[model samples]
Target: MSQPADYRDPRSLRSRERIIRALRAELRAGRSLTIAAVTGEAKVTRQTFYNNFDSLEEAGWFALLEDFNTLLVDDIQTRWSGASPDFVGLASLRKIVELLRAESSLSLLANGYRDEAGLTGLAAVMLSEIRRFRAEFGDPASPLAQEEDLYTATGLCGLLTVAATGDASSTSIARAAYALLPEWMRQPRL
Candidate 1:
């Protein structure tokens, strides 16, 4: 017997991409980020938007995390040369600055628009990412490594927050974040 034909719709995928792009455009333009604005900009209906995401803030966070994952997860080896801790930190910061320069609006909107609970949630997410990165690449067996990971993640998040809310350039913010990285990341695994 012949198999049934597959049924799939590409319109939903296209609509999702359009919605994300519209959200980014709104962020870049420093315009109001409302469902109506995003739906209008995306030229997709509210039903389409809701189909993709629950809310505008959810969409923004998804985009921000997606960008960071692309940079951190996809290019881990190339970006992280297991050399001196300072070198890795600087290189990572440089790459982050490049990302921020390319599309900082997402970060700005994600960090700036959130309330206390939202900000706490974002921090927790960032902390989890840092812990995962350490477990994957650094010395997770050491207690010091765990503590250092928390410190570095907290400091970096603070720096990003300051840069997002203040007038500091991303380059400067990255430099500050780089300084917060501990040298223990280069410690040899026992």
Candidate 2:
């Protein structure tokens, strides 16, 4: 019989964590990412790195996705717990834009130059989170339903893209996202 995958193996977990930490450090330093840098930083051979991840982009993607999810959840809990109905949605939007702008790993992942597969995976996670939010809070029908979600996702993606290129201003990005709120939410309150 074939053996099941062993994600709990200490060596495997350590290797994965090392790779994630290396990627995070590289991104924070604003250094150009390469397989050589990752392997060297993680103290692993090229073959070892490849065994843990398909490519450098995949390594970066995993790190960024984890950071993004954690930050999103934490920011929501901290900033929106007792906010007024209208302010809640806008505050969430601003927080997202600000978070994306500040997180270099996310900015790198969303840039157009990264692996398309990784980018698509990140997009899927973002969409899933938004759906979960709607389900939990009640999805009041907005005239811009699909458009609003897509636009918000795309705008956040764009914000990260610009930040990766070193052209984004956090204040401006947050303002733009907040500005879209009135039209994105359902009228007559719910």
Candidate 3:
């Protein structure tokens, strides 16, 4: 399974870490990401950055996804206990917002460069984890269940990108996301 970007050698790992840190700093400063700019900021050779990542966006997205896998996915899996779908969906959305807040650079990269940074790839990672969650904690997912999961995963990526870039508060974004949850997952009114 693809966890984080792991390296066998300490030197390579250190180089990659420096590159990611530099990417984050560039993003925080609202600088355009380019190989030359990143390498200069990282104080690494262009070849060193290339050895670690194909592009500046790739490095940013990879770091973001790694954190998502470690922080959100693991936490969700740990919390699963056949809870109602509404509970799971809302909790997951809230956690995503919290994750983005904690990692401002990742949020900026994801939001500012949504298409370039490959948010769809992030959604795919989320889908796989959602599939795993269903397999372990609930009944075998039906076609409808799978569809719901796909929508939830993709929708969140788009919604989160908007939340990061727009004026919407995180709580407001969460509320809107909750309201838009798949009907099947929503609780019935009293």
Using lDDT as the measure, the top candidate is 3
* Candidate 3: residue 173 Cα off by (Å): 2.3
Supply candidate 3's per-residue lDDT for 126. Answer: 59
Indicate whether candidate 1 or candidate 2 has the larger TM-score. Answer: 1
What lDDT score belongs to each candidate, Candidate 1 first? 0.65, 0.58, 0.66
Report lDDT (Cα) of residue 180, candidate 2: 47
Give the total clashing residue pairs for model 3. Answer: 0
For candidate 1, the per-residue lDDT at 16 reads 71
lDDT winner, 2 or 3:
3
lDDT score for residue 118 of model 2: 39
List runs of model 3 lying over 4 Å from the truth. 1-7, 77-92, 98-122, 128-148, 179-190
What value does the lDDT take at residue 151 in candidate 2? 58
RMSD of 1: 6.8
Instruction: Report how far off residue 126 is in candidate 3 (Å).
Output: 3.5
Which of 1 and 3 is ahead in TM-score?
Answer: 1
Deviation from native of the Cα of residue 159 in model 3, angstroms: 2.6
